[model samples]
Target chain A: MLLKLLIFPGFLFLFLCALFFDWVDRRMLARFQGRVGPPWYQPVADLIKLLAKEDILPTGVNPLTAAVLPMVSLAAVLTAGLYIPFGAFSTASFEGDLIVVLFLLSIPALAYFLAGWISTGVYSVLGGSRALLQYFSYEVPFLMALAGPAILAGSWSITHIVDYQSQTIWIALMQPLGFVLAIIGLIGKLKRDPLDIPKAKSEVVAGSLTEFSGRKLALWHLTMNMQTVVGIFLLVNLFMGQSSVFGPIPAFLSFGLKSVGILLLLSTASALYARLRIDQLATLGWRVLAPLALVQILVATWIGG
Target chain B: MASPLRSLAYLLPQLWRALKEGPHTVKYPFDPVELPAGYRGRVIIRAENCRGCSMCVRDCPAFALELEREGRDAYRLIYHPERCAYCGQCELSCNFDAISLSNEFVPGKPDRKDLGVVLVNKEG
Candidate 1:
């Protein structure tokens, strides 16, 4: 159990996957923009460099909150990682654990909000408010989108969802609207551009991250990347069918390829679109995505029954 | 709303083409760059043809050039890269054709001493 948690399908595995996935996203985005991206080791290099830098605490900021929030976020993501099945194995999972995973997934954003709120900078405050606003905007539809698969599989367990998909067809095909909505929600959840209003560089200077530097910032970045991996893992399992279609090796390959494909699609979207305004984001997430998610749930229910 | 959908349709094909084309960035440092014609870079001095003329020193907007007398009509031409704007004014001001710009754009040194170029006129 210790080995499983420390290594495969847990902290180390998920951490590496997060870094690699981030590299893939960056590389694909660079290719889309007709530029050579950083080398494969760039993420590792960035982490090391950030670690080597001096941690600067801004005035009026609670040092404990500033230092601890990133670790809390990282812990949330790593804990969520244990619930997400990798290839054919999950480090930790139980019946109705999907709800737990869903809750865990939001903790990082909450951490960001707290980190921002505890900071003295006006930009951090603005970023914190925006983060809260973004949380409200996307969380509902994201859960609703997840509901499509949960309903279709008749189980709230991720393993069962994958099992159901492997026996029949991927949920993505069965609930196409839900899949699309889920992907959109995933983009917003990950804070990618077009949905990255909180940390809009031009406006808020990294939003909630404006005050963090050195190791704290590195941990925060790692948390964000791990969230990306977790998000992609959830999407793949819920929609791309079970990874163990053939065997362990084939499962790993297919899972990797599908993850890359999804990452590329995300990178493409991020590259193509500009950042949405806070108002536009709210409208899109609530006015558009919420209704779409509802319709998908209705359709999924009818078809599932 | 429809416009965004329309633009997405337009964007998909372009994105596909871009992906197929692969990355457009040049592998700089590892691979040599093909600098465009008339590209102005670091200035080089031709000490043999130089007559210790200070026109370059006077005309330099960045004050990057200095001519120190080493002997009678002999001078040491010092180029300080820290101050150089790479505007090629020094290269243009040399009537003796003593200085010209090279296409090497990599400012590779961290130390200012490594960046400074000194040329001494031997037959002044």
Candidate 2:
């Protein structure tokens, strides 16, 4: 109990920072709209309210699966978060690699799919299907882009990737194609806006989260925010160095802020755009992005080789 | 397949607009939103024509309007703006036609007390 309590503050801090980024993104977008914007501390207020709200379980749903969905996603994320090399917070050297982190990121989607299907609704099933399909469409290009740095660094370890960037020029300059592809992949992973076909508000009514209310909705919502932070971290650590020293402050805060910028670009861009039809996303990925990524990889290797 | 690409092609203009245009999403608190036609805003009331007869108070389903005493014929109209359901029922049945809903649905309130619109009829 004591040990867990001690760990509590650290966990709270990570989550709070994650929530902070989400709030900042929203507020920034609100700023773009010429609004006063949410208070900087809005995410904290939202989470506190959520925690206090009662958890509503689905009636006669697979209790085990329903219980497990958020747990598995949260566990995988927290585990992956361990490997994420922020300035001072990144601790473990190599309990996992880039591939492992990438794969673990998918666990949330698995939990999401199960959550959708177990809810016993048509929209849930369709949404779950769309989610899985989205997984396949985007994961390939994303991995290839992720592999862009690995190709140069010649290692799968995220630390190695970051340390490699720290040694060399940032990967964004060397691999613009990879960077763009990776960002698109990141957007897909976050399931925001155009790629939010799974829970497309037009069709599925929050899709997987259709039946969830109160605290369950809140947990999923919070996790959604955390996922954006994680996605941004992966982008930063892979393409932008998290540990490079700056004037007085370690560049971790820079990572945090820039991640918010990328997320801001996403959320605003999303508000204006409509969701892509499922088939379009598939064809776009397979026909366009896959080829682009494969060629970039071939070219990067050739130039570097 | 064809349509999405087409849609993507169509969306290019919007992207171009975003790139070329200034920030169109007007800042909220510091800068106010431009209320276009059919702008759903808080209800505003004209104080004079309203008779002390409480049709608006009775007609309001959301209980957003209040007929309070300010002075003789100066009935204090406290409009709890947040309590407004935007149902427009209060706007419809104003027999004196003293009240009208504006397009300015800002939802701004420092507290529940601040949400009210207080007006009194004067014999001007």
Q: Against the true structure, whose DockQ is highest?
A: 1
Give the DockQ (2 decimals) of all models. 0.63, 0.12
Off by over 4 Å in 1: A243-245, B1-4, B34-37, B44-49, B67-79, B90-99, B102-108, B113-124
lDDT of 1 by residue, A1-305 (tens): 99999988788898899889989989888887777888999999999999989999998888887888898889988888899887788877788888998899999888888888998899998998899899899888999999999999999999999999889988898888888888888888888877898899999999988888899999999999999999999999889876345987888878888988898878988988888888888998889999999998898889788
The lDDT values for all models are 0.86, 0.75
Stretches of candidate 2 off by over 4 Å are: A1-10, A242-248, B1-124
Give a tens-digit lDDT track for model 2, residues A184-270. 898888888779999998788888888776666677777777787777878888887644546425465676676666777676667
CAPRI-style quality class for the chain A–B interface of candidate 2: incorrect
Tell me the alpha-carbon RMSD of every candidate.
2.7, 7.8
TM-score of chain A of each: 0.98, 0.90
